[model samples]
Target: MNYFGLNHKRNNISRDSLLLEIYTMNLPLYDLTLIVPTFNRQSFALRNMRYWSGRDIVMHVMDGTKLGLTPLQLAQLDDNIHYHHMPELSIGERLNEAIDLIETPYVTFLSDDEFFIPSALSSCISQLKADDELVSCMGLSIQFEYKNGNVIGRRFYQSLENYSLLQTDALERMLAHMDPYVMSSMNSVVRSVVWKRSMRLLCIGDLSTFNIGELLFELAVCFQGKTKVISEIMWLRSYENKIIIDHAKTKSFFIWWRSDDKSEDRSKLLSCISSILTKTSNEREMVKSFMLLALNRYVNTYDKIIIGKDFFNDIIVKIWLLIPNNIKNILRLVLKPFIKFNTTNLILLVAKEWSHEGVKTNFIELCEIEKVIQYFYKVEK
Candidate 1:
């Protein structure tokens, strides 16, 4: 650790700073780096960068803007942030450049318009250091919208309180659920080494597709080990319909399905599925449950099929053949009803009746129940 702005290692540290140090250990021990990739949100970029100036951090803005900074403004920010102006680059290229320049052991990206919580970095870094197996940590996302002059704050995931990554064996049960875990790029903090490896995987896929980076990233990191959830709303994800892609948030799913990329994507995904299945003692049941979750999400929205039905069905059958008869019967009873429901109703059912407990506990609870009729029936219109 650099020990740049911190007190002696043995001294009692303040709670906030202790949290900061905990978050810091996972990264390389120098000052942290915040990579902001901006297209035209100059003002937002400036404001967000200013918030981190005095902290033990450096801000690098990959400006994809045509306008150059004046000598006066550049000199003023010289002490705070490094401005890399390149109006010609795409978002992906700009991000890649930022990735190359980061010298910190930890690297995280924030949008020009999105604001992070004051202690977000500290919390995530702290959690990472405390758990050696935790490859990455992400804060919860809360959406606060200003519509018709009203400000409404809608919280998505809870703040990470006691949640940390479990062993790989435990992760198998977690990933089988419908909403396994969310990978929010905005609020996630990763070890420098893991980030680099995941980035290499992302680069293999087309950057233009929505979530192409995220999808590949989640698969790579999850395969290595468990990822912890902090549950804090470190990020405020703004609503942008155009930016939301089918699989990820990109131009088209075809970008992931292009002839040259298909085999690679398919192989990577299947490998992930196979690895996940291999670790489980109840492989067939787990596979069926995974399929039920996938089909539920797909039938809820045709978009889920973008990965291709053949690919999807193949995995389902493989899982089915591997699972025990008892497990398959249980999943069918649990998921078959919502299999044909419309998206709106399906979502309502999930919110109303789905398990409030985390994935692991919920799955265990399912086994104890003689029948889940109380949780499944009587859906509100």
Candidate 2:
């Protein structure tokens, strides 16, 4: 089946016939290019790329590893696969570099440790072909936590039904629920034109924040045309064995707000948002509501991770003092899920939830769960 859960036979047959015709004329099937950015993970990247090399798709590897792909490793790649070695660069810079080289009509980003379901790619390409106005498409992703080459836990992320947003207020709706829409790059495919245009707004020299740039670019693409979400699981993200608390501790929240170098760039990023909002025919009230909602969600999500507790406390105090009581109540309701009594309580809550699910404790059991996912997604080794 395709990413939209449609039977593959219909779509595959047509695509196959077209490919045969192209091959008869000695042409290339370069409708979509998969951009894989790697950093110090040659083995994982090579293994992941090998699976995709078998497919009739273009695979671009932006290798930023310390010790780059060896001659033997380069020889192993298929002809459709292209590799570019560069000195270490930030993820955003690496992505921009890869974007420059995309010759296909559509481009999708994948990390060294991720792989897409072949059927999912085919489905996305078919959808883009059918709709000229569609700028972006995405589906659910299955994430796995592994240790010592063994899967330790699994969770499903970003499950949204097959729905398209083509109205004037599409950007507002997307920003209002940015948590689900602004997902990992692995879960999305975008028209090359849309991607390039969006990047131009974010790529403002070294001031560009990586995480925020990605979110803004995704929003920009959706604002340009129609955006669709498919419910099926189309990507697998592998993570090292790290608990939520550990991950949170290591994460720097709102880098643009905390970093001296990035704090000034925040205005430029906001201006880009304002530009897109102005172009769309959304009302002022709708824009204000969505921007506030998005900001509240963003603040609540990173409250605990922001550089210093004192800074977060000051921000909360300012919010309480400046905002009217009615608005404060509304904000509280919106941020209820993220509101916490204390750090201990939040940690306990997380631990309780994690253990309540009967967390997998054995490698064999983890492998069994992986098998089920592979079977459901029709993934072949």
Candidate 2: count the clashes: 0
lDDT of each: 0.52, 0.57
Give the candidate number with the greatest lDDT: 2
What does the lDDT read for residue 375 in candidate 1? 18
TM, every model: 0.55, 0.59
Clashes of 1: 19
Q: How good is model 2 by TM-score? A: 0.59
Question: How much does candidate 1 score in TM-score?
Answer: 0.55
Give the distance in Å from residue 165's predicted Cα in candidate 2 to where it truly belongs. 3.9
- Positional deviation of 261 in candidate 2, in angstroms? 14
Regions of candidate 2 where Cα sits further than 4 Å from its true position:
1-29, 145-153, 158-166, 179-186, 200-210, 241-265, 271-381
In angstroms, give how far residue 102 of model 2 lies from its true place.
0.7
Over 211-299, each residue of candidate 2 has an lDDT whose tens digit, in order, gives 35555565556656777766444565666423224333223434445577864565455555565445554553444445445655655
Per candidate, the number of residue pairs that clash is 19, 0
